[model samples]
Target: MASIARRPDGKWRARYRDDDGKQHAKHFDRKGDAQKWLNEVTAAVVTGTYVDPNAGRLTLRDFYLEWKTRQVWAPTTLRAMDTAIRCCTFADTDLAKLRRSHVEQWVKTMTATLAASTIRTRVNNVRSVLRAAIRDRIIATDPSEAVTLPRQRRTEHAMRIPTPEQVGQVLTAAEDWFAPFVALAAFAGLRIGEASAVQVRDIDFLRRTLHVQRQVQNGPTGVEVSAPKYGSERKVYLPDALVTLLAQHIERVGVHGDDGWLFPGVPTSPRNMRRAFDRTCERVGLDLIPHDLRHFYASGLIAAGCDVVTVQRALGHAKATTTLNTYGHLWPTAEDRTRVAAADLMSTALDARGDQLGTAEG
Candidate 1:
């Protein structure tokens, strides 16, 4: 129920009871203004888009903080989201007053200093907060719903996949203890964090497999063990050479127990690992990071005729699409397969005819 009445002070008061029976009132200088405000409220109610006048009083930052507590995001992701929210220009703006223009302006500001991917991450983080606000009825629509983002420039040349020869040189240049760690990434396709978390028992020498269970990540409380990215826990088969190398390293280093880390100490720290890897690459006269080894491993799988699903599983990707998107260029095209098949058919027919002629002549 809503009403407009003139008060003794000559001010027109508009009051209404919301869906929950809570009364909201506002005073205007003229009766038409009060009636117009009431009509808008009524129309909003009829359209089922009614947002309580007080609900949107919370600032974007306040809403983000509230929404953040309920997320099950990993510590790294939480840190990233926190950074993104903190960098928002409209962080102090009330959610009720936030418009698409504000979000667009934020994107424009970020594009000036941030990379395309970084800008997208920041924008997506804010978009998620606004979506939660909508679900909570703090706002009727997402301010970021129509905001434009910079295009992510990803091409085949963007990803650096180190050559097998270069990888071998780097592995050979590595110290005895570090060679096994390098092999796991280049041969077994484990991320540096996953490699750091590998236990002695996680390796099955007989089965020639490595079970990825967790990853060592930088959490809110410093270095901690957590589930793999996107929970991509799976077994990756090891090459015979890598299996032998790991066995020898384990024997020489001596693990404390079944739960002992495969490459303990400095190798587990991603920063230290990168430094060591950089040193090894310098010695081999190649420029590469440890992550480039993973690309090498994926490329090898594609060359060996592994399908998208097989490569995805080997690389511990959460989705087959992720595998295809990253390594699609490496896979053979349908035309290549067709040409190979046609050539093989022609060669077989020619060989058979020659054999028949030899038999008749005999």
Candidate 2:
């Protein structure tokens, strides 16, 4: 309930009790101003957009600290969220007073040095914090909601896909221990982390397949073994050549049991893997990372007439749209196929018509 009353000091007092039974009051010079304030509060309550008058005094960082504990983020995601929170410059600003200009300015500052996608992630992180505050009834609206963000380019053009020859050269030039690592990425389309976590038991020589179940990830603390990326746990078919290579690699490394790591003695971390991969690239005179090999594998699939869903499953992408977003350009255009099909049909019909006309004339 809300009411406007004339105070003993010749001022008007507008008072209301919130849903929680706590009362709030504002002193105004005129009775009209007091009633207007009550009307606004009553409308906000009716519309289910009411916020506690004093709750929004907490800063963004304060809310983030409380909000983070409730999130069930994966290790990589946790690290990324922490990074975004730390990087947010307006974390000290009060949620109620935080304006869209503040978010826009923060985005503008990031545009100078950060990529569009990176900036977008950071902005989204801050926005999530604001959205939580809204849900908690600390703020009425999200300041970051309407702020403009930098545009991210389509991945198909941005991704660097290495050629088959370059992939072969890298595989050949890689050191004995690292060759299998490169092969898994280039041939099987495993992420560096997933490849690093591959154990002997995960490989099936008879079926020529690799099971992806776990990954080595870098969390806030350090490197840790964890489940593969969401929807990334899958079985990937191996080519006969790749299967033979793995068998030889296992024998050479003296790996016997299912529990044995494929790259024994090497740290199962992306940093170590990248270091080894960089060395191999230098030896082969190619400028490429292990991830480029994954692109190489995906491009090979697309070139061999694999559909979007087929490539998505092969690469263990969580969604087919992710596959299409990154490699859609590699797929042949439907319009091109349609035009060819129409031309062939028209040509056959015309040829038959010409033969009939010639026979009639004869």
Which candidate comes out best when scored by lDDT? 2
User: Which candidate leads the pack in TM-score?
Assistant: 2
Worst 10 residues of 2 by lDDT: 256-265
Q: List residue ranges in candidate 1 displaced over 4 A.
A: 2-15, 25-48, 219-221, 256-258, 346-362
Return the TM-score for candidate 2, rounded to 2 decimals. 0.90
Instruction: Extract clashing residue pairs from model 1.
Output: none
lDDT of 1 by residue, 1-362 (tens): 99998999999999999978899999999999999999999998898788897999999999888789999988888888899889999999999999999988888888888899899888888788888888888999988886779988684868999887888898899998678779999999889888877888889999999999888875555677888899489999988988999999888976644468776563266666778888888887898878889999999999998999999999988899989899999898899989999999999999999999999999
Q: Could you list the CA RMSD of all candidates, in the order they appear?
A: 3.3, 3.0
Q: Which stretches of candidate 2 lie over 4 Å from their true place?
A: 219-221, 256-258, 346-362
Per-residue lDDT, model 1, residue 193, is 87
